[model samples]
Structure formats: structure tokens, C-alpha cells
Target: ANTAVKVSIDPAQDGPVINRHIFGQFAEHLGRGVYEGVWVGPDSTIPNTRGIRKDVVGALKALKVPNVRWPGGCFADEYHWRDGIGKPEDRRSRINASWAGRPEPNSFGTHEFFDFIQQIGADAFISANVGSGTVQEAADWLEYLTAQDSSLAKERAANGHPKPYEVAFWGIGNEVWGCGGPFTAEEYVTKLKQFSNFSTNHNKNMPTQQVAVGPDGDGFPEYAEVVMNAWSKRTWAWNIEALSLHRYTRNGWPPNIPATGFNQKQYASVIKETLGMNDFIKTNIAIMDKYDPEKKVGILVDEWGTWYAPTKGTDPGYLEQENSQRDAIIAALNFNIFARHADRVRGANIAQMINVLQAMILTDKEKMVLTPTYHAFRMYVPFQNAVRLKTNYDQGVYKEGDINLPKIDVISARDNQGRIWVAVTNIDPKQSIDVDLSLLGKSIASADGEILKAPTIDAVNSFAKPDVVSPKNLSLKAINGQLKFTIAPQSVSVISVKSQ
Candidate 1:
């Protein structure tokens, strides 16, 4: 038997409130992500509310999704808001130059998105088109959504609803270093400031939280420095409240990595990349701390998650891929990384929330299936809104090829009900590890939990086998003030213990 890994958690010591927004999701206008997977058209045979799938809505609500970003990633920078408004029939059709070059029908636009968000009880975080749009266009879109009274408000009312949509978060652009625009950080900062100035809060009751397009994962420090430096020198505060960052966990850049049926080497490589996010957050936050010592602006990892080659015959533009138990461990590690840094990591939306890369749910016509990543999210819900608790653990190492990773990853939290929750992932592909639990603040009176695993690491769920990888009840017992349990290899486990 391998030595038991030890874990210690302190409930009395509190840190940042793991903001609900940090558990946010992203739904871009890519492939079936918005069209069939989310909006199935009102007249379709599927049961839907305003063209949004009822099953999809129910699943997202169960996850307690706090927010959903809309419109685009690279697509957002090129999207023209006007084309998606007024009438669905009258709305213009355009080529999605960013993804798969598919013709965008503009059927599910701003109104439809809000309808979906409302049904799911999530907030909207809209990304503006800065690469191919004007400041006036950006400002007018906000006016149309948030203005209580005005000609644009009248135009919005003419479309359908008379009330303005309450929008709190707005992204100035996406990936200013690449698809967003070709401007240097200096030039982009000028544009970001200009765009923020006009994105006014017509609804005084709901103030807007403006987010500037930040650097990509590789472009940090240098890109972040230039923008933060500009903001520091300004005589007044920039409207920007958050700086965005995008990263993807993959074996290589793009189009080479496999989505499923990978060997242990490939899996380890991906795990190595996912684990690197911890350093990414630290270094980026270090730069943000340099300029804004008080952390006035947040670090929004708006685009993140596993990205792999498209499924064999599917359009590469659609970014559709099969998710496996491997992806569940990936999701678990990344979410824990975000929670560990909850203080500055204000919000994150995993890339393409449905029927796309690393999606939570996949839908074919009227049929919907929850992926392992979805179950991982469901299991980790207790981490949301709870205060972070410092956890110290002796981590075992898993090695493959040239990569070596900590065999275990974890995050701990204490909810308002005084229940202590610990989420743990054992990433070792071959061996289950015994864990010795130490609860710091109080003794564990009782413990119960669920574990998500499968017979094989590559095990995945489909419409024919939806329950192939769902969570199962985990057994645990508190022995002499210490709770003990065995974690399966490549599995995600969440344990909630009530302490007196």
C-alpha cells in the first residue's frame, strides 16, 4: 500500500468569498452552442421556452450557474449588435469568420439570450464587438439594453419588451492581442478607455462593471504591464473594473490533440498544462498587484477549459468534442485552482458551455446528456459563495513522459450552515490513494459524500449511456477525530461533514 496522503483544513481561518460569478459559464454563438444546443427555435418539436431548450435550462439551473457570457469569443469582437436586433426574420445573416466559417443566421440574438438567462436564473456578461465595431455602436447597444427612456429604449420596446434589460458586466473586447485587434497594449489601452467611457450606466440602480480585454495566457506580464501602467498614470480612474485572460488546457496549440481515447502520456501532458494555471494566476495577479495594490480591478479568466481537435467528421469550427472521465478531472483541478485564488480571481466562464469544446451538456435534436464535466461542476457547487479555507496536504506525484504532476488536487470551504466541504481529485491514472483527513476548526460529527468515476479513465457518457459516469455515494467514517477515505484514481470526490 502507498503511504497515506495527509490533508489539513482550517474552518476558523477565512479568506475570500468564493464569488458565485467565479462559477460562471460561457455560451458563445459557435456551432450548436447557441443554435441547436441552447436555442432550438420556438416552433421546433422540442419543448422550449422562447426557442431555448427546456432540458438545457433545467440542467444549468441545477448547477446553479451564476452567470452566462454571450455572443462571441473571437466572434464577439466581429459581431455587430444591430444585425441581431429588431426582428428575427429581418435580422441579417453573416459569415462567422472566426469559427468554422458557418453562416450565422442571427436567430438567437440579444433578446433570446436574455430569455435563456432568465429561465436559468443567471446574470448576463456581454462581450462587445471592438475589432469591427464603432464606439457609438457599443454605446448604443448598452443604451438599448439598460436605458430606462430614450429613442433606443423605444426601439427596444418596439421589438418586444418595454423594460430595459439589467446588464451589470460588459467586456470591452476579447483577446486584444490577437482576434480582438492588432493594436499594441498601448494602443489597445487607448481604445479600451474610450469604449468604457461611453458604456454608460443609464440604469442608475444597476451600475455596470466594465471589463477590458486582457492578454492571452502567454501574453501576460508584458501585456498586463502595459495596460496597468497606462491606468496608473491616468489622472482619473478608467471605467475598467476587471482585466480578462484566456487560456485552454490542451496537449498542443490547436488541431493536433485528440479529444478522447488518449494514452496516459497525452493525459499527463494535458494535466501538466491544467496544473500550470496555478502559476498563471499567481504571476498575473502579481502584475495586477504591482499597479493596483488594493486589487481594485479583478482578474477575469473569461475563457478557459480543455480544447482539443474536433471530433473526426465534425466541422472544426464547431469545436465539438467528446468529454470523458479525463475531462472531469481536468474540470475539477481547474475549478480548485480558481477557488484557491478566489481573492483576485473574481469571475471565470469555461469556454463553450454546451455542445462545443469541453461542454457541460451535449444535445442532439431534443435529446440531452450531461457530460462528466457537468457532474464535476454539480459536485463542486458547495464551493460557491462559501468562504475559502486554507488546506495543506502532502501531495503524491504522478509522472508520465517528461511531465510530473501532483497526484492529488484539492480545495476546501466552509458554508454558512457551518458545514465543512472538501473537494478532492486524485489525478494518478493507475493507483488509488488513501487519504488521512484532519479537520482543523472542529471535529467531524458525521460525513457523507459522492464520487465521480468510471471503470476506465476514458469512460464517457452518451445519449445511449447517460449514466455511465455519474457520481456515486462515497463511504466515510470519522475515526478518533480524523476522517479517513480512499480516493479512486482519476476521480473527483466531494465530502461534506457537519461539525458541532
Candidate 2:
């Protein structure tokens, strides 16, 4: 029997305006993620502007990417900003020990990344190196990018970017518990203060917002306890505005489960695990509340998405995988969870933007293709900067291999343009779910929808068939203030309503 989920939404009752920054992206200096994924030097056959691929720039622009975190995951912790500036030919090449031990040409340095960010009109969220780099190095890097009058300004002009860049978000460090520094919570808290103290705002135009490394969801790491507790003790001097959290649904390490070719049991396991982010956010928020009582610090899930084993013959450090409809469902579920907790959740960056774990776009040489995840993001774009509406739904279960998941996941919001949009995801790969939407006390004259779905759970858009899972127009009508629709199995649907 097809499960039925009921959603009741009240437009008058609104929550926080969903932060547009939550739709942020990450670009790490790993594998082709940097070199071929986004950059393909100016002289190359691939159409590029000053080395960055134009096609990728155009696509990311369409998504209206809010902010981009550059030069890392673990890569930022080990990177030295100086190596990426100056002449591309003169830039030094270093071994990327953090990712697949590949050689980083340093061709795509600070200038190139900022150029790409400018091309797409996205804000910059930089992750500074703290584990191995010195305080002066981190401080100088900030000065070089944001300072108005400094030797660094002349240095920037020497490097080709004459004007000072505006960088508002600064990540103090990344993954301090693991790849970052292996520091104890107490140890990291002290270092966090020390490093943040030096990260000054040179450009008064854009004041920087410092983000401290929080914890990995595994065991809900104790770093949060020590850092938050310490902040409570010394609130006056605390400079951190956010805490970063990273979580991935890899099922198991090393022998990670397959990305595309998988059975429902494997899919169910991944879905169940991805759903665990809700608890992770809640647990961390409780800790944040206890320490700050006022919610002064925001939570940024900076590194997230489904990380699977590399495609068969690929380099292990590349961290590449194929995205499928399952990934689309997972993305929708995660976004919905974030929207529900918009107050404390300020921003999130999908593990990567291209050619990496659960990426939105995939590029081969000059050819680029949008993945199912891309369409999922396109469908949910209206939720950005929109006022989250108060919603309640009667949940139904989607059972597979002893694991039962709530059949329907949803987020409702009213955009600044005076439009109401509802994003709904039916995660069941086998059965379609009928949704009965009641816009309480709010009248709607008509409704239109776009849905991304496929025939099977593992259905994907290959180079040969890029549009296999793109969003399609769906005909919908609101009858007597109620909208009834059937969301396809393993699908994400976005519906927009015009009021009476």
C-alpha cells in the first residue's frame, strides 16, 4: 500500500529566514577537483577565462552559489598560501600528502580561486592553515587578501590582483581532531584563540567572521565540550562567530560501499546513516545552548555529503564517486533538516562542487554534465533566503531490510518575492507516496511543480545521458484550498503556489 503523508503549513507562522549562505560549496585542492575540475589554464582547448573553466563558472552561477570554501578539507591545514601566488610558472609544486599523494602545481592559487569566486559572484569562505603553518603566515595571508595599506598590498599587485579582496568568513582551522592537528579539545581551544587573535581585519569594508573547528559526528567528539565550555568562561574575549562540523555517509571506511551499483539494502543503510545528521545537529546544539545560552555562535556543517570509495581504478586520494538518485534523495533530506533548524544552522557546504564526493557537476575534458544532485539543488534553490514556514506533518514509514525511514521529508518557505515554495522528498525507492497538503488559513489559486526522479534507486545521469534525471514540469492544481499530489518513489519535488 502507498503511504500517505499529511502536511499542514501556516504562512502566518514563520521561522528564521533560511540563510542563503547555507547553500555554500567547497573546493579542495585534491585530485582533479582543483586542476581539471574547475581550472584548465587559459591556453587550453577548454574555454577558460584566465585559467578557470568558463562552463563551470556559468553553471555555478546558475545555482547562485552563496559562498565557496577554498583550498581545502584537510588540504587547508597543510597548505602554505605563499606557494600559490606569484607567477604560475614560478609557483612551486608540492606533494599533496593529504589527498592521494598527487603533485599540486600551485597554478590555481589565491588569485585564481578568487577569480573563480568573482566569476560566479559568490562570497569567500577561506580555511586558514593552522596545523603546520605559523601564526604569522596565517595572519599575513589574511593581510594580503584583506589589507588596504600594507607591504602585502604591493605584493598582491605584484601577483596580478592589484585591488584588495573582501573575505568575510575565516575558518580558524579544519578537522582539528583528526587530519588537522590531532590536538586534544583543551589543546585546540588554546590554539584556536592564539590563531584567531592574529587573524585581523585589514579591510574595514568587510569584517571577518571567524569559525572554529567543532567536532566530527563520530562519537560526537569532546572538542565541542571543551571549546564551548571555555567560551562560556571567557565570553568577553571570544572572537569565534561559528563552529564547523563535518559528517559523511560512507557506511564503512577503506572498503566503502559502492556509489552507483548497489542494492536496496545498501541504499537503505546509507539513507539511515545520512538521516543521523539530525541527531548530530541536535546533540551539538544542546551543547552549544548549555554553554552560550544565547546562541551567539552559529553552526556550519562545512564538510558534508556521501563519500564513497573511489571509482574502481581512480587514485585513492582523489575521493571521487558517481552520484545517483539515491544521492539526490539524501541531499534533499539533509537540506530539509538544515531548514528545520535554520536558527542555529547558518551555512553548509556540500563535500565538494565538482568531480568529487556527491558533486553537483561532473566535467570530462571540456564536456560538463549536471548530476542528479545538481537538479536537486536547482529544485531547492527557492528555499535560499526565504522565510521558513511553520510546518507539521503526519509521518509514514518506508521499510527496507529491517530499516524503516519516514517516507516523506519536507521543507516549506516563502521567498522574498512573495512566493510560497514547498520542497518534498519521497525516499522510498519502491513505492510512491501521496502527499495531502493543507495550507492552513492560506488560500492558493494554483500550484506548479518540478520533480527529479528516475525508474530505479541507482538510476544516474551518465555523460551519454546527462538529462536522465533532470527536473521535469509537473501539472498540479489546488482544489478548495488543498493540494493533493503523488511524489514518485526516490524523488525530490518542488512546488510553488500563487496565493488567492
Candidate 3:
């Protein structure tokens, strides 16, 4: 029997406004993620603007990408900004030790990154190198990007960009407990104070919020406890406005899970694992609330997404994985979770932007194809800055062996333009679920949006067949203030409702 779920949304009981930055992306200097996936140089045959791919910028703009974190996951710790600045031919070269020891040509540097984000109409979230760098180095880098009349600013002008760039968020360091520094929570807090103190914003109009490294999911609550405790006692001289947390959905490290050709058991395991993100957020937030009762600090899940073993023949260090419908569902689930905790959950960036992990766009030289995860991000654009409406639903169970999941997941919000948007995901892989929505304080006249559903759970889009998994138009009419719709199994749908 098909499951019947009832979702009650009260627009009158408006909650926190979901931050648009929650839809941010991360672009690292790893694998083809930056080299071929996003940059191909002006001399290449691919259509590019100042060495940045045009197709990628166009596709990301459609999603209204709020921000992009650059200079990487582990790469930031080893990257020397000075090496990536000057003339391309004169630039220094180093081995990407974090990745597959590939030659780091320093081709795509700071100027190129700002240009790419400008083209996509997104803000910049840069991660500083504290593991292998000094406070002076991090401070100088900021002056170079945000300083107006300083020598670094003149240096920036000598390169190309005469004006200072606006950096929205500055991550102190990434994964300080691991690849970043392997520093103890106490040791890292000391470094955080020194780095945050000197990393000043020269562009007073655009102040950059500092993000301190936090825990690695629920496993290390001590990291959050210590970081927040330190933040709680921080003086006006040195403080952080946000804390960073990193989490990824995967079977295990040295990933044994494959991105394709998985069976029902594997699929169920992945869904069950991905759903744990809710608990991860709740656990960490609880700790934050204890130390900072006023909620002055926000949590940024900077590195997240599905992590499967690299596709066959791909470099293991590259961390490249194929994205499927399963990935799309995971993306929707995380978005819904983020919306529920919008007050403290200010932003999040999927593991990588292109051709890495669960990416939005995959590029092969000149050809590019949008992934299912890309469609999911496009569909959820309506919820970017919308105010969250109080939603209640009786979530039934969908069981596969020992793995149990909620049959249906949902989130509804009222956009700035007064349109009510509802996102629903049917988690069951075999049976479709029926949703009956009752909206309070709003009489729905009609509803329409896009639905992303593929023939199978593992369905994906390839260069040869890009449309294999894409969103299709969906329409529904409300009767007596109640909207009815049937959501296909293992699919995500976003509906825009207009009041009568």
C-alpha cells in the first residue's frame, strides 16, 4: 500500500529567514575540479572569459549561487598565495601533496577566482592557510584582496584588478584537527585568536565574517565545546562570528562504496547514513547554545556531500565520484535539514562544485553536462532567502531490511515576493507517496514547479545523454485550501503556490 503523508504549513507563524548563503559551493585546487572542470585558459578551444569557463558560470548563475569557497579543503593549508599571483609563466610550481602529487601550475590564482565568482554573481568565502603559514602571511593575503590604498592593493592593481575585492567570509583554517594542522582543540583556539585578530578587513563597507574551525560532525563534540567555550569568552579585540563543521555522507573512509552499480541494500544504507545529518546539526547546535545562549555565532558546514570511491581508472587522490539520482535525493535532504535550522545554520558548501564528489556540473574538455544534483540545486533556488513557515507532518517509516527512513520529507517557505514554495522528497525507492498539504492563512489558487525524477535510483546524466535525468514541469490545483500531489519514489519536487 502507498503511504499517505499530511503536511500542515502555517504561513502566519513565520520562523527565521533561510540565509541564501546556505546554497554556497566549494571549489578546490584538486583533480580536474579546478584545472579542467572550471578553468581551461584563454588560449584553449573552450569558450572562456579571462580563462574561466563560460558554460559553468552560466549554469551556476541560474541557481543564484550565494557564495563560493576557494583555495581548498586541504589545499589551502599548503598553498602559498604569493606563488599563484605574478605572471603565469613566472609563477612558482609545487606538488599538490594533498591530491595526487600533480603539478600545481599556479595558473588559476587569486585574481582568477574573484573573476569567476563575479561572473557567477556570487560572494567569495576564502579559507586561510594556518597549518603551514604564519599570521603575517594570512594577514597580508587579506590586505592584498581587501586593502584600498596599501602596497598590497597596488600589487593587486599591477596584476589586473585595480579595485579591492569584497570577501564575504574568511575561514580561519580547514580541518585543524586533521589535514589542516592535527592540532588539539586547545592549541587550535590559541592559533584562532592570533589569526582572527590580524586578519582585518580593509574594505570597511564589506566586512568579512571570520569562521573558526569546529568539530568533524557529531563524533568530535569536544572540538565544538572548546571552540565555543573560547568564543564565549572572546574579547572585542579577537572574535569569530561563525564556526565551521565538516561532514560527508559515505559508507567509510578509504571509501569502499562505489558511485555506480549499487544494489537496493547499498542504496538504503546510503540514505540512512545521509539522514544522520539532522542529528549531527542538532548535536553541535545544542553545544553552541550552551556556551553562547544569544546565538551570536553561526555554523557553516563548509565541506559536505556524497563521497564514493573514485570512478574506475580515476586517480584515487582526486576524489572524483559519479553523481546519481541517489545523490540528488541526498542533496534535497540536506537542504531541508539546513532550512529547519536556519537561525544558526547560516550557510553550507557542497564538497566540490564541478567534477568532484557530488558535483553540479561535470566537464570533459569542451563538453559539459549537468548532474542530477545540479537539477536539485536549481529546484531549491526558491527557498534561498525565503522565510521558513511552521510545518508539521506525520512522517511514516520506509523500511528496507534493518535500515528505516521517513517515508516522506518536506519543507515549506514564503518567498520575499509572497509566493509559497514547498519542497517534498519521497524517500522510498519502490513505492510513490501521496502528500496532502493544508496551508493556514493562505488560500492556494494554483501550484506549479519542477519535479526531478529518473527512471531508477542510480540514473545519471552523461555527456552522451545529458537529459537522462532532468527536471520536468509539474502542475497541481488546490481544492478548498488543500493541495494534493503524488510524489514519485526516490524523487524531489518543488512547487510554487499562488494564493487566491
- Give the top-scoring candidate (lDDT): 3
Q: Cα RMSD for candidate 3?
A: 1.0
Considering only N, C-alpha and C atoms within 3 Å, which residue pairs clash in candidate 1?
none
lDDT of 3 by residue, 225-257 (tens): 999999888898798989998889977668878
- Residues 1-500 of candidate 2 have per-residue lDDT tens digits of 77788898899998998998888899999888888999999899999998889889988888889999988889999999999999878999999989988888898999998999999999899999988988899999999998777899899988788789999699988987888897888989888888888888788888788999998876447878888887777645457889898888876567487887899988988999999999999989999999887889999999889998788888777888888999899999999888888899999999899998889889889899998988888788899999999888966777887998888888899999989999888888888887888788877688999999998888888889888888988778788878888888898999998778
Candidate 1: list runs displaced more than 4 Å: none
Q: By the lDDT metric, which is better: model 1 or model 2?
A: 2
Candidates' RMSD to native: 1.4, 1.3, 1.0
Comparing 1 with 3 on lDDT, the higher-scoring candidate is: 3
lDDT of each: 0.87, 0.88, 0.91
* Reference-based TM-score of each model: 0.97, 0.98, 0.98
> In model 3, which regions exceed 4 Å deviation?
none
* Residue range 1-500, candidate 1, lDDT tens digits: 65479899987789898887888899998988998999889898999987889999999998999889888798998899888887778999999999888899998888898889999998889999888899999999999998889999999999897988988689998887788787788888889888888788687776778988777766645778887787777656456788888888865566577777889998888888888888988888998899999988898899999888888888887999999999999888888888888889999999879999989999988899999999999998888899989889978778887888899987899887877899989999788889888887677778899999888888989999999999999999888778889988889999998775
TM-score for candidate 3, please give it.
0.98
Candidate 2: residue pairs that collide = 100-317
